[model samples]
Target: MYGKKYLFFISFCILIIVASGCTIGESPAEKMYEHLEQTVSLESGFAEVQEPLIEAEQKEQELFNEMLGLSMKEIDKIKKLADEAIGLADSRGELITKEKESIDSAYEEFKSVNGLVDEIDEDTLKKKANELVETMEKRYKSYDDLHNVYMEALNMDRELYEMMKKEDLAIEDLKSRTEKLNKKYEEVLKSQDAFNNLTDQYNEKKKAFYKEAGFSTTDKKEAS
Candidate 1:
């Protein structure tokens, strides 16, 4: 009878151990780790959303470059390319704006968390998270710069159409618009460089945190 009782006791103890182990699996550290994963995911998604805009911008650039190769007499071709470029910009502009706003909201939500996971209780870790957020915030400036470039293109398109409608187009005006557009593109490039640097830093810091916290930093999209 005592042997049977001992056996039952051993089984009961094993069950309790397993139960506690499962409970312990969901720790503050794990919660924080999950939150960080969410942040990284959102950032990566934003980058993907930007790809279309980047492609469209490149197309617009090619059109602009082609304009430089042609003579002022190729006004019809210039007008057509400008119209196509404008169409591309118009189609993507709203989507980019919407995606940026969505990502901004996600970051805002993350910032609102009283404390993200137990690991963030550490001053250094919290500071790193904050810095990452700041960099993410700074990325908006690139969008602003890009908008300026877009606006310039739109204005140039309007002005060019006006000039093309005339019997005798002013070569000087077309040349001036092209020069101004190129200058604006240069500004956009600079902003893009800054944005890219920040993105690299954001990814590095995110990976470091995930490493320290024992989370899988691999992106799900990439894994697939």
Candidate 2:
């Protein structure tokens, strides 16, 4: 009877060890998913901040159009509009700078997941996670490109306004500067489009990764 009791005690100890192993905190995959979700949440304000930037740009464009219709003889009017335009450009620049900072923060947060990716046990999941990281990095790079081009366009715009304030501004100089500014804007548009496309692609890839990894898709934020 004592031998049988000893055997039962050994089995009970083995069962406790197995259960403790199972209950020891979140799995590696779960930890990585939670980290990724936190990184995504950091970008939640991105779209919200963009609205004010758009409004500021629109105001600047209206001021530019109004200034274009004024004659050189209206020097005071031209200077006033030019000052207003310069101020608007400065404000727009501030908004863009803030937006860039937000993206930079998100990028840094996303990059922290590299160690978590390494901890993932499943080969396929690890590969998918790495791919998600690559796409997100590309998306951030694309935004950086767009931000540079847009800031260049804003600077050109400020230069054009400063030229307008000059009483002796040459018609040819104005025309050339305006043309160059338009071209710069065209480049900005192209960069914006590229950034947008990469963002969409990254979102899709992230959604797919979440689904494949068996993460909950019910959270609308994660669904994005």
Candidate 3:
């Protein structure tokens, strides 16, 4: 009878141990280990997802800053040209209709560049959280010397157009210069047009870039 009682007590202890663990057939140590392993796996998975996002965001931001620094250098050059044009226009009989049109076109291009540069702070920063602002500043000076040459050409087109229109200039000389001026003028227009188009494309392409990055852009426009 004492043996029977002790056997009952041992069986009860085993039942209690089984009930304390989560599963029917599993031991407490095994279940505890499984729970700990699952916790670590979840933490690892979460980190894996976050790490790439942070890296991609940084890459995208670097590109953006590169682009913006290129833009600000561009803006400064354009501003200088605009100021020169404005000063020249103030002079007597300095600007005519076609020359004025070229000046207007150049001014418009400046405005477009200015607008894009101005949008960099809140809108772009929010979208490109990991971007390096300092990197863009470093890139700005490199593009300046190259971009200045193109800006100079834009100014020359306006100036040459005015020079040839002088009443003192002979028709033969004007005729000869006209072809060359027109060619240079066309090239300048083409470059300015490209810059304008790129700005527009960049704005529209934001949605696509954001979508690819798994961040939803407002309105979520589909990429073509």
Top-TM-score candidate index: 2
Clashes of each: 0, 0, 0
List model 3 lDDT by residue over 185-214, tens digit each.
Answer: 455445444444443343344333233334
Q: What are the root-mean-square deviations of the candidates from the true structure over C-alphas?
A: 19.2, 19.9, 32.1
For candidate 2, write residues 1-224 as lDDT tens digits. 00000000000000000011122247665665665666656655565566676666777777777777788898899899889988978987887777677678877877777778888888888888888788888978987888888888888888988998999998787888887877777787777777767766776677666666776455333122
Residue-pair clashes, model 2: 0
- What is candidate 1's lDDT per residue for 181-214, written digit by digit as tens? 5565566556556655655555565555545555
lDDT of each: 0.51, 0.68, 0.33
Model 2, residue 200: what's the lDDT? 68
Name the weakest run of 10 consecutive residues (lDDT summed) in model 3: 5-14
* Global local distance difference test of model 1: 0.51
Candidate 1 lDDT at 73 equals: 75
